[model samples]
Target: MLGSLLLLWAGLLLLYFLWKTRRPKNFPPGPQPFPIFGNLLQLNLKNPMKDFEKLSKRYGKVYSVYFGGKPVVLLHGLQSVKEALMTRGVEFGGRPQGLLVNDINENKGVIIVNYGPSWKEQRRFAMSTLRNFGLGKLSMEERILEETSHLNSYIDKSAGQCLDPQTLFHNALSNVICAIMFGSHYNYEDQSFQSLIRMITENTKIINGPWGMLYDTIPLIRSLPLPFQKIFENRDKVKAFFQAKVTEHKETRVPGKPRDMIDCYLNEIDKRGNDGSSFDDGFMMVFLMDLFVAGTDTSSTTLRVGLLQLMMHPDVQARCQQEIDTVLGERKQVCYEDRHRMPYVQAVIHEVQRYGSVVPLSVFHATTQDTQVLGYSIPKGTMIIPNLSSVLYEEGQWKFPHDFNPSNFLNKEGEFVKPEAFVPFSLGPRMCLGEALARMELFLFFVTLLRRFQFHWPQDGGEPDLTPHFGIIQGPRPYRLGVRLRGRQSG
Candidate 1:
């Protein structure tokens, strides 16, 4: 009887393997996946970006790769990405369920939450509220400029000394969002805010690291204690911090009058009042967390990488400063509107975003329903990985796609011209919620800093490494810059 049972189990295992390895009819082609393990073995979890790029060459763009028996479509190049994210956006606009990020977030936030009533409701509300609170308006620019002043002072103190800008930029950007979220900004010396920034940095690193890959691929091992567990721990701590803020808001908030995002949300909840809407305290906590993380990380990382690029290319830096000086002319501060008059400076900032390619993969998107990309059928709920790096660095897209050159954004007339492929912010209905605020902040901060200080690689610091340490967001490897006050500095 024991021998018979073993034989039956062996046959069942074989059948399971076959089923898992099989692909649906008309599915985009890719490397054959291993049973159970799927294509996990084929990727370098540490950083699968280059691996994905290589596979695109072998399997063509819009190919599929399996993660633990689940097939995910990887969209490459400008054409495929545009078709999926723009032409057929709604059909390909759902977040993947049961992933590490969704699980950690409990799928309540605006980012990873599924596309449906709740997502629609939260997104609409967030967008309107942000605009009302001055996202793209002059009021919002004022808020960002205020934060830029703090950043200038912080850097001013370290002038002519070797200083690492990682934390400085992170803290500055975090405080910018904090004002919008909490109606106030934290002191540069605040321990709690610093801790919060550290957690966000660590979480972004882990979310794209090897452990995050392992957690996503193998369900059987998820319950085991592992480094990925730290993600959950960090999530809990962040949730608690944001939750406390929510509790405090509830105490001080007045109905029909909103101070910031939290106050606006509370007013919204009251207006909806048990209407069975997605508006509630539970979702609000995660929503706040999402806004904070989204608002802070990418822009900050871009600034860090932008500084590195400037240090490496002093000519680019000097030219930008010259443009800034010519345009501002003793103004003592730069504004968002000033970008129009300073085409070269605008080009350099855009190039920084292009060269940085900070959020490379662009938060994983899933198929909301059955869809077709370039005639290949993608089933409902299939995972979509848009290789934005492909388009950003596509061979024919820009004059110098592989190198950092402001000319990428400049026309022969020396005017700033954004190419169709310059999508550092992913294009779609579900594109970055904080896009306008980020653009304004990047312009104000970069212009302000370049006007006030000249950033250069330290004398002892050998060749600056242009290669960014890959994460969910790419950032420069830790390096310090020597700051010298520019002639006629901005106050």
Candidate 2:
């Protein structure tokens, strides 16, 4: 009986392999797949971007690779990426489903939902909410300046000691997001607030990490509770926090005055009343979580990377400080417009984004209808990966694509000139919705922090490791630095 059962199981496994690896006619060329596993084993799961970048060199511009038996078309080089994302925006604007996506909000939010009317509504509402909340005006700048001051004060309290600024930076950014979404911000020492920040930051790291990608490629991994328990736990904690806030808003909402994004959404829901629009309480929770999480991780990580890059190149840091000193002398604070005056500083900031390429691979895009990228027919529902890392670091796009040089953004005359290759926020309609807001935060925070403090690798301690913890978003390995009030030096 045991022998017979084993034979039956082996035959079933054989059938599964035969069925799973079958490809459609005219599929783009790619590495051969193995039984059941597909091309996952070929990838360095911890650093998939490097593997993909390497693949692009051999496979030419448009190519396919199997991740867990599914074909993902990777558009390499700047031209192909632009042709797909920018030129054929609608054709390649849909979001594909995955374990992480479905498990959280069931693909309801702006980032994960399919390209359709629902996506259109949520995106429109989100942008409208930002506008109504003073996204680009002086009011928004005031809020950011307040949070920037909070970050500066925290560093001030450190008194030049060796301290990791990771959590501190996350806290300040979280406050800005909180104020925008929930109409309130938290103190850095608040225990509950700290917990929420960890939940958001850590899970994003895990989701972008190798294991996260692995689970994403294979849906079966989602059923195994033990491997990704912490991620799910964080998901639950964050949603619960959002839910609680929703409940509070529901109970305490005013009839006329809409205080924040949440209140605006809730009021919209009531007004819609039975129209069956996508404005339910559940949708509100997911949307807020989406905004909160997306808003927190990217900006904070950008700040962290910029700080590390500056520390490693003190000469560059000195030049930037000199520029800031010369440009905004005696102006206790900075606004977004100041970027125009400090060209070197602007170049360095842009370089940090290009070199880091935080979201190395953009959020997965899908073919809305039958599409062709570079003459390769991509069927409807095919997953599209416009490797922004490849575009940012593509050989011909930047003079020194491999190096972390600010000159990449500056020309012979030493003025800031943005290369067409610098699309860190990505492209097309589904591009990062918070692009402007994030740019504003990075500028204000970098200038504000540098103007007040000079950061350095500790004299008595070891040099900081520049190696990034590769994930969905690449960020510097956690390290401490010494900080003290800057002594103004002339250029």
Candidate 3:
């Protein structure tokens, strides 16, 4: 009886394997799959980029990998990514519903929604709202400068002492988003604001680990009695928090004058009169959540990496200081417009983003329909990931792709030259929605801090580790830095 049972199981497994091997006609060729698991067993769930890079070399720039039954097409190299994302941009603009993003966002937000008329309408509304709120205007610049001043004061209070810097940076960055979204910034120590930050950070961390992959593969585990269940509960808590904020914003809506993103959205809702145009409270809440998540982490991580890079390469730091001193003099506050004059400072900022390459693999995009990428047919619904880090680190694209070199952005005449492949904001229709806001914040905050103090490695330590700690967003390993007020003579 035991021999008979084993034979039956073996036959079933063989049948499954045969079925899985029958690839769709014209689907991109990739590694083979096994029974039940597909090609999932071959991927390094912890760090899938390495696997994807290796496969790209084998299968050319565009290749496919199966995550369980799902086929994900990895778009590598600059040309391929640009072609698919830019030339035929909107056709491949749909966002895939990952286990975490789906549960947390529920298809309401601008960032992780499907490419349909609904998404188009919501995105248009958001773009218009941001413009109306002075996102690229002088008024917005003043608000950012105010936040930068507060940040400088906090760092000055630290007074050259060893500090974590994460919380301080996060507070400043989150406040910028808060001011834009909620019509006001919170005290750095406010319990509610702190809780919001903690929840967002926790969700980001949890969703990038093994359990996240497990949930994606077998969603039923989310309901199973396990520690992973807490992740779901926390997700709900985050959504509820945002929902409450939405309700408050709606109840306290001010007509004739829109103060923040919520107010602006509510005003639009009033104007449109709830005609199912995707400009409702639910969309507003998700949009706010998107800003909170993308705005906070990417800017903070870049600033953290910027400080670390400066510490390691003091020469570059000194150059930046010289430019700041020359441009702004000893006592003037830095403004967003100042970036145009401070070429070296701008170059350093660009290089920090290039070297850090925080969002290594951009948020996953799905082809809205069957598409041809580099002569290979990618079926509709095939996952598309633009390996953004690959472009940032491409050998031919930068002077020193692997090293932290600000000169990569400088021309022979020492003017800051924008590289064609500098795509930290990504390219095409689904590019980061917060690009302008993030750029403004980074410039203002970084210039403010540099003008006030000099950042350096701890005196007791040797060179600090520049190796990036990979999470959903890549950042430097935890390291303390010494900050001292920049004296007039030093400037």
Candidate 4:
């Protein structure tokens, strides 16, 4: 009886293997699959982009890879990414409902939702809300300048000592986001605010590890009463914090004038008056959470990477200082409009983003409908992942894809030249909603620090490790840097 059962199991396994090899005629070429698992076992999971780059070398710019049982078409190179994300934008606008994002936001927020009337309504409302809160106006500039001032003072208080700038930079970035979303800011010592920040950091760290992949493959694991429970508990903590803030905003809402995103959302809820569409309290809470997560981490990590780059390459740092000194001599604060005059500084910012490429694969994009790319048929509901790092570091597109070269963004005449492949904020309708705000913050914060202080490697040690600690976002390995006040003779 045992021998007979073993023979039957072997036959079933053979049949499954045979079925896995039979791909549709128009499907893109990829590694062959085995029984049950598909090609998922072959993927690195921890650092999938490295595997993705290797596959691109083998299977050309655009090809398909299977994650668990799902099909994901990976787009590489500048031309392919632009074609899929830009020219044929709407058809490929849906976001996938997977473990990492769905477990957190649950298809409600602007950043990770399917392309539909609901998504359209929420996105439109958000764009309008940001504009109402002085997104690109002098008022908005004042908010950023205020945050920069606070940040500079905090760094200056370090008294030219070496310290890890991560927490300080994170506080400044999170405050800017907080002011935009909540119409208020938290002091550095606020325990509740610090707890929220810790939650954000933990989520980013865990979601990029093996456990995240395990959850993605077998979501039922999240239901088990163990370590997975902590994920939900943490998520609830974040949601509850936002919910409380939303309730506060509702209580303080004025008749017509909106104060921040929460106020604008509350106003919309009042305006809609049981329209029963997308705008609701639940949506508002999720939207606020999305803004908190997306806006804070990416900007903070980029700035951290920028500071490390400056320490590593002091010549680049000196050039940026010279430009800031030349442009804003003795000015109390740097302004957004002054960015154009500081070409080298702008170039360095661009280089930092490109070199870091924080969101290496970007938030995963899915196909809303059946589509074809580069002569391969992408089925409806197929996952579309644009390898953002590939575009930023593509050999033909960048002068030194690996090095921190500001010239990559400069012309022969020494003016800053924006590269077409520079899509750090991504592309198409789903591009980062906080692009303008993030750019303004990075510019003001970076220039402010360079103008007042010089970032140098620690005097007691070897070199500060410049290697990145990749999470959902990539940032530099933790290291301390000396912050010496820049004197007039420096420039």
Candidate 5:
């Protein structure tokens, strides 16, 4: 009996391994899978960017990798990514289902929901509603500048001291998002506000770390409690926070006069009442949460990366400041319109984004129908990972693809020029809707802060580590910088 049982177990294992390794017809070629583990064993779950680059080199620009018997097509370089995300966007626009992140998001919200009529409707409503609340207009600039003032004040309190500006920057950006979503801002010292920022930041790390990868690949261990459970816990807490704000808005908001995004969405629910529209209180809560989280994380991480790059290359910082001074010419503050004249400053900001590649592997996309990229077949439901880092640093696309030079964005005449490969906000139907707002905020906040202060690496801090703490959103490793009022020069 014992011999018979052992033989049966061995036979099942072999069958499972064979089934997992078989490639679909016309599928892109990839490295051989290792039994049930797939390519997970070959990757550094905590930071797989380098591993991905290595795989691409070995398997060509377009190749496949399996995560627990599931094949994910990785698109590298400008040609392949453009073909998939732009040329055949609608065909490759659907979001993957049954992943850990999908589960945590409950498969709702504009950012993660599968492509369909409902998603299209929600996205249109969000874009229009945001515009009604001053998006891409001077009124939106005023809102960002208000937060800039608060950010400046906080830095003023710590001027000439070595400090980690991570939390400071996060708070400023979070407040900007709050003003848009909730019609209010929070003080830097508000504990509740701090908690929200903390939780969202933590979620970004956890969702892209080892546990997130494990949860995505393995089906057997999901039901058992694990560290990844923290993601769901944090999600619940954030939902509760949004729900409270919704309750407050319901009690106080006027029917016709919308105060912010929330109020506008509430009015939308009333207008679509019983019309079979997807607009409702619960959907609104997750939608608002999506806007807030998406708005805060990417922008804040970019600022952190910007600060680090500026400090590491003081020459770049000084040049940006010189341009800022020349353009503003004693003006109290900078505006979005001023960016058109400040070419060098604009180049630096764009270079910072390109160098950082914050959203390296952008949110995973899946093919909506049977399609092919670069002559390779991709079946419906195959996951697509557009390697933005490849395009950001690809050869032939930029003058200096591997360096952190603002000149990459400048022509011989020193005019600002954006390369087609600079799709940091991504491309196609599912592209980020907040691109305009984010660009405005980055310009306003970067210009204002550079004008007010000069930042440098701490003298005793030794060699600065430029390595990023990789996640879904890449963030600069924690480090301290010495700050002083601009033009002081003397130590």
Candidate 6:
């Protein structure tokens, strides 16, 4: 009787394996699957870019790999990614849902939610709110300059020493978004704000790691007492922080007088009440959290990586200072208009983004309708990973794709020329909504720091590692740099 049962179990497993691997005749080519795991065992688990590159070499530009039982198409090179995301955006703009999104956001917010009427409204409203809040005006520039002043003051008192810049970057960047979203900025020493920062930092680390991928791939096991359960718990704590803020705004909000983003959203909600949409308190909380994280992590990581890049290449740093001194002429503050006169600085900024490649994989996009790419059929609901590293480092798209050279964005005339492959903010309808604000922050903060201080390697002669920490953003590991006040040359 026992031997008969064992044979029956083995027979059932074989049938399931065969069913999972069976696909339509015209599906993209990929590695053979052993069983329910598919080619998941072949992946690197930590850095999937290397694995995807290997698969691309074996299969082709458009190929499929299964995570658990689900099929995911990995698009390699610039043309393949553009064909799917830019050309066929409406068909491929939807987001795939699983434990990572549904369990965390309840299938809410602008980035992770499926693209449709609700997503369109929320995204459009959010972008417009940012624009009305002075994303292009001197007011937005002033917000960044205010944070720069605080950052400079913090660094000034800790002068002549090596310092880890992680929290400093977070505090400054988060404050800018807070002032925009909540109508005020927190003090650097605020305990509650510090706790929120900790949650956001922890979230980025966990959400991009292998465990998060596993949870999404095999959500059935999520119900058990497992380590991955901490992600949901941490998510709740972060949500509660924003939820309380929403309540406070509800009680104190006035009619016809919007103070900040929260107020504007509240007014909109009241206007559209009982219309049966996703415009409510819960979605609003998730939206605010989305803005806070998107605004904070990538920009802060870029600024952090920017300092390390400059430290490694002092000549580039010196040239940037030279341009600033020659153009601005002892100006205490640099504005958005100043970028028009500073090409070298702009080139350096673009190069840092290309080299850093923070958010190496564009956010996962799903097909809302059946789509065909490169003469191959991509069924509706297929998950697409547009390998951004392939685009940023594509062979013919860049002059020096592998090096940390600023000439990648410069012409013979020393003017900044943006390459077609420079999609650091991604592209198409699902492109980064914070492009205007992020560009403003990057320029203002980069100029402000370089104008005031000179960053160098530690006095102990230990070299800082440029290898990324590989989270949501490919941030540098927590490292220290020697900071010194520069002369009035760049003032």
CA RMSD per model (angstroms): 2.2, 2.5, 2.3, 2.2, 1.3, 2.1
Q: Which ranges of candidate 4 are over 4 A from the true structure?
A: 10-14, 17-22, 488-491
- Per-candidate Cα lDDT values, in order, are 0.88, 0.84, 0.82, 0.83, 0.89, 0.86
Q: Best to worst by lDDT, what's the order?
A: 5, 1, 6, 2, 4, 3
- Which residue segments of model 5 deviate by more than 4 Å? 489-491
State the lDDT at 29 in candidate 2.
Answer: 74
lDDT of 5 at 480: 88
Candidate 5 lDDT score at position 189: 88
lDDT of 3 by residue, 1-491 (tens): 99999999999888876676667877777888766566888987766777877888898887777776677778887988899999879878988876667777778878888899878888888788778788889878888888887877777677757777788888888888878887677888899889989988877877787777777777656677865666667766777887887788767776868778777777888888957688776777777788788879999989898998898888998888888889998667777888899889999999999999999888889989878877778777777889999899888988888888888999999898999999999899999877898888888888888877888778776766776776668888888878878863221
Per-model tally of clashing residue pairs = 0, 2, 0, 0, 0, 1
Estimate, for each residue in 186-285, the C-alpha lDDT of model 6 and write its tens digit: 8888998999998777777677877777787776777887766776787889888888888898899996698889999999899998999879988898
Candidate that would win on lDDT: 5
What lDDT tens digits, residue by residue, belong to model 5 across residues 1-491? 99999999989997888786788888999988877788889888778889988988988999999997899999999999999999999999999999887887777779899999779978999999878778878889999999999888888888888767788888888888899988888988898898888887788777777777788888788888999888889989999999999999999999989988989888988988898877887788779889988898899889999999999899999999999999999788888999999999999999999999999998899999999999999999999999999999998999999889999999999999999999899899988999988999999999999999999988888888888888788888888878998867635
Q: List the residue pairs that clash in candidate 1.
A: none
lDDT of 2 by residue, 256-342 (tens): 588888889988888889997888877787898889878988888888898888888999999998998898888777888899888
1-491: candidate 1 lDDT, tens digit per residue:
99999999988987887786678899999988877778989887766889999999998988998997799999999999999999999998899988889988899979999989999999999999999988878888889989988878887787778777888888889999999998778888898988888887788778787788878878888899988898889888999999898899899988888889999999988999989999998899899999999998899889998889998899999998898889999887777889899999889989999989998888999998888998899999999999888899999999999999999999989989999999888989778988888999899999999888998888889877777787778778899877889863322
User: How big is the positional error of residue 189 in model 3, measured in Å on the Cα after superposition?
Assistant: 1.9
Name the better of 2 and 5 by lDDT.
Answer: 5
TM-score attained by model 2: 0.94
Please state the error at residue 25 of candidate 5 in Å: 1.7
How far in Å is the alpha carbon of 233 misplaced in model 5? 1.8
Better of 4 and 6 by lDDT: 6
